[model samples]
Target chain A: MTEFDREQHDHFLRLFMGLEESLRVFVRSLLFTHDEEREVMQEVAVVLWRKFDASMDGEAFCRWAFGVARMEALAFRRDRARDRHTFGDEVFELLSQTVLEHSDSLEAERHALDTCLQKLPEDQRQLVQTAYAPGVKIDHLAAQLGRTAMALYKTLHRIRLTLMDCTRRVLATEELT
Target chain B: MNTKDPRFEIIRRSRDGNASSEELARLEAGLREDTDFREAYVRYMNLDVALSAVAKAAPLPLPTAPPQRPRWITWRPLTAAAAGIVFGMLCTSVVFGFVAQRTAVKKMPLSVFDAGLEDAKQILNDGLPSQEGQWGIDHAKVVSADGKVTPLTGLHMLRLEPIPREKRVKNHTSRAYQVLDLRSLSASAMTDNAEAEVSASFCAANSGTSSRYLIRAIALDEAPAKATKNFWSKVESDGVVSESQRFDTAPGSAGWQTFSMTLRLPPGSKTLVLIFGAVPPEDGPQPASVHYLDEVQVSLLSSETPLP
Candidate 1:
């Protein structure tokens, strides 16, 4: 208890909790799936807290944590290379830097995606939810829906397309509001 | 979204994990070459991750055949992500289980307080006080707003009445209480500086009268059920430490206004009862105008930390 002040620990929790989701999203973008990010995120969180400075502001913490997540994920990816297909490190660097630059727009897009998801046809929304649910296998989902795996992937792709369009339109008009 | 755009297809396939080695190479080339394509890549990746989170947090009934956990157990992304900070890296599994178990109701914090009135009921006077994570109204009622009465936050708010159904007497004040079990707190978790920082938003549903609200929180050495038997009048008998905060709304208080108070938790505090009261001035009419309370919160805090 003496190593860290109780107030500083609480402050760390507040800042960490506030930014957890963004950090999760950042880590997830680097990894393959939800479960993979789960492992890396744990390490990233530990490192972040172990090195957290009482003086760092939220923005500084975010940038630093995202950097930690990027490093941890890339390192994890190196060991996980044999199991799955991964984009080149060059692509990862590009996307990571781009997301940081467009953080505001990405945040807007995050909220807009929520709105756009609600705008979908009910069945499509359900399909999207069921398809992306943690641990749901695409083949099983396709079979459950009585469609071929390829057809189901096409349907999901179309739904994402619709959602992306809606989100773009929302962001475009967000300035007017 | 333009189906004809090859870069868009590559981005979508990559997100869906349907891209081949050649397709991934093309995607990497596209990202390195086109600025807009790179933007699209980040957006798609963000969307992909968000969709997975949304799917996990989606309502309990998912249509797929995936192995599903029980409905009550919700996987809060942040909780899992923050578990490591509570314990060391090796203890994260333990901390995560503790937190994940603590949240029986999804989207609700792992605390004894329910700020949003979602789990509360309208049972009035002599009705059992709220259990942990609920509000037990003595004379008032927790009600859903249909249109005539509006809640400050969620669909429901705590409504304070001037008279009690059980007591039918001249009482303009209403009381609601919630209890917290502190046995789960590891002895070393919080220092003596641990405080319960409570906050709630209040609004006057009527016109032309100031309404006051107060919170009485006491830390006891016994269980809440035992403490509630005396309704905290015996706190003095037990020599327990208690704190109270009172605020009065101005005439025509207008929009929802929020207030906060902090109560320090003394050592050996096994149970905590958070008492909420809406008191009309003693000299005012016996049955004052109706007032609404919402967004009630009770958070454990370090001594100096303030509730927002």
Candidate 2:
């Protein structure tokens, strides 16, 4: 590869790596199903790389990237519009706006979530990880645990709420310093 | 935290894509109207995303084995089938009951103007009566702005001009306004001290023009035919009003900006009017300008505490 091409490739990777987590969060907020979210995120990454120009500054990258992600999400929704219980377009708009507005706080919360996950008791953490593992179905997990699906969902919900509360407290305390 | 908070149930159902039509509508309205609910929904969704990310980064563990069945299961097929049928029936009933409850709570809000300026005009001319009373618009034309003839998503948008061309040349200044009667829409759900949220997307033809778009929720003791006669004074006299920040696009900018504001409905108010208008620039070359508006919505923000 030419030196210029190599430099461009490296810069693209750096920006992708820096914003990967936020991009994933943003895409997932618009999409509920994991597979679709992953598909859209991959498409967004490719688009961002192909369009990476020097005019785009680091500070504006997230906003620009999110705009691309939003378009991808809208397309995905159109493709899946016939699916049962799909979110309305207004919901997607609201979510996109909210994520962009809270991107900074969300990044902090993401970090705090990592810390919070590590602090989870071993069994609870294992349950959460296993439940979210790439192809694991919640129904199958519930059957394995000898619990009803509703019970399992409630348990997972509690864990999520706990993490949310913990992250909020951590961010609040951080703001005090 | 209440483990049985209905909001959590709604969020969970929404995340799982099992939320019925009514539940979905309720969730959307809540997100638009309540700050705390919106924040909670965003945080929960973010945490779910974060958890999934963490799971993907970590190595997967071996799957757990299913519980063992008794060896005599072969001989008890008939008995098991009978029991299974009974269990299936019970499960079906429970599922149906849940769905019924969800749909039962569905309250369709009175839609004043959802889309198509022609339909809005027809309704205005026909004087459609809503729960609160009759509804009409002052002066609105469906016009394309900045070459965006089509809406961001819909087919048309209402362009409210601040000053008509003929009137602008005559007086060199005039306030053109469009008011949509929202009393029927708001009165159906809002009580005294109830909070409602109004949301819309707006854009200006030229950023340099003194053109400005303002969305206001005014509580009136009675419906007014036109918005021009001391509306602000009446709003002051009536004492319950909420207005969004005046929105103006930057020069050369070409995109729709979303604006949302929450308002408290006052007691004894018979009508709620949503006013959208452009204020003509005093000294700009383009004294008359049209402000494009679309996707106007109003939803009540419930303040009820979730049941334990």
Candidate 3:
């Protein structure tokens, strides 16, 4: 075989095997840990390898690979079904993927920070919830929620900083479509 | 804004601290220069108040305790003496039994994995013929609750009775489930050309983890076999919102895995095909025979009720 033949073989092998790494990255972008993402990627690669045809163009192949990855991710999500959570894994996966792809600017991150009310944990959620509620005073809320005025100040400060950081991460990772 | 002003530091430290009037004035001026800082500071102060309130409240609920046993009473001496005599004879038998019990019986309880396997076998036995090629031996195991294939056979002439919304589930290994609802969407054409559309506006209905389902259309075959590639491509190219996102898995995952997609059906399209097959890993076989599926669902995406 000529050198061209060897190069061609390498290209196909890369096409076939490199799909796994791309998928792993995709799963990671969905917030799945490296190992969990790899496990799912393994299943996807096996399926793709079996079904793939060399006749498929690169564009078609990428779409198909993405589709397979999405399906596998969904399947994984369904299998680990949780009853308590509101949004499903697919929505998060898609949203996260889209967000990461489209919105990578600092301005977007800052805006996300300004609107970072969604990611707060339980107590923080309640505090923000009350603060956002109509006509509620901070002093009255402090008294009702039973906080020392000083403690309330500190907690709010920490929450803002955390939200800012979280917003930056979220913006860096995702775009709203 | 320089740090050297002693009066500025005092203003910073004392919101209510025993600070002189002069120090307070200095702090106010510094805050006036940057409204954002003052806003952030006030926000922090408010949060401190709220967190303290929650901690003061009672703890979250705890799990219940087990039931208590009643106290035991002592027996009389004469009765106790008689009971001791009976116990002596019982003790001799118990000792003999203990010696006999030394032999290994080898009778062990079935494990959960074994139980799951047994359930899969039972499901295949009863569900295979009735499932009409919709069921394949994949990594997905048969869930006993929804594995009722026989009773559903020919009742609708379609072997797969979609596991009712409540009972249907996807195990980790299994990929997707396609329930073929052949009912036509268009009233004018009593034929199969009718289409179902899941547009972006209604994407919420299908955009989720477990609740999401894929759309694939396949013809009913005599042997419960898979549909042709032409069928898959036509349905896919026409109905799929993003062609790159269409996925299928091989038949052999040992159980049901879940595949979810947000489908936006093209306008004026007549049909939607959802394939619930598993995608094998890259290192695995080409055109792998992991599993096969013939069952699929056809419904109007925009309609309130899915076609039967």
Top candidate when judged by lDDT against the true structure: 1
List the global CA lDDT of all models.
0.62, 0.56, 0.33
lDDT of 2 by residue, B182-251 (tens): 4443342444324444556666665554445565666555554533255555554424454444555556
lDDT of 2 by residue, A97-117 (tens): 777677788878876776677
What candidate 2 gets wrong by more than 4 Å, as runs, is A85-90, B1-5, B60-308
Enumerate the chain B TM-scores of all models. 0.57, 0.49, 0.24
TM for candidate 3 is: 0.22
Interface RMSD over true interface Cα atoms for each candidate: 6.9, 16.4, 28.2
Q: Which stretches of candidate 3 lie over 4 Å from their true place?
A: A1-12, A17-20, A81-177, B1-308
Q: Comparing 1 and 2 by DockQ, which wins? A: 1
Q: Candidate 3 residues A1-177, lDDT tens each? A: 245633443344446443433444444333222233434554565456447666777766767877777776667656652321122444434433442343224224433542454457767755654543323445787898788766774565456456655665676576543
Query: For residue A29, what is the lDDT in candidate 3?
Result: 37
Per-residue CA lDDT of model 1 for B1-308, tens digit only, reads 25356677776676667888888778778877888877776777667766765665443363244233312122111101101011112111111100111111111112434455654553443533534545677667777883456875457777777664345555546777777777665554444445555666667766467778876777766766675676646666534667777887777667676666656566566777777777766653544667777766554542211122
Model 2 / residue B252 / CA error / Å: 57
- The whole-model C-alpha lDDT of candidate 2 against the native structure comes to 0.56
Poorest 10 consecutive residues of model 1 chain B by lDDT?
B76-85
Q: Local error of candidate 1 at B305, Å? A: 22
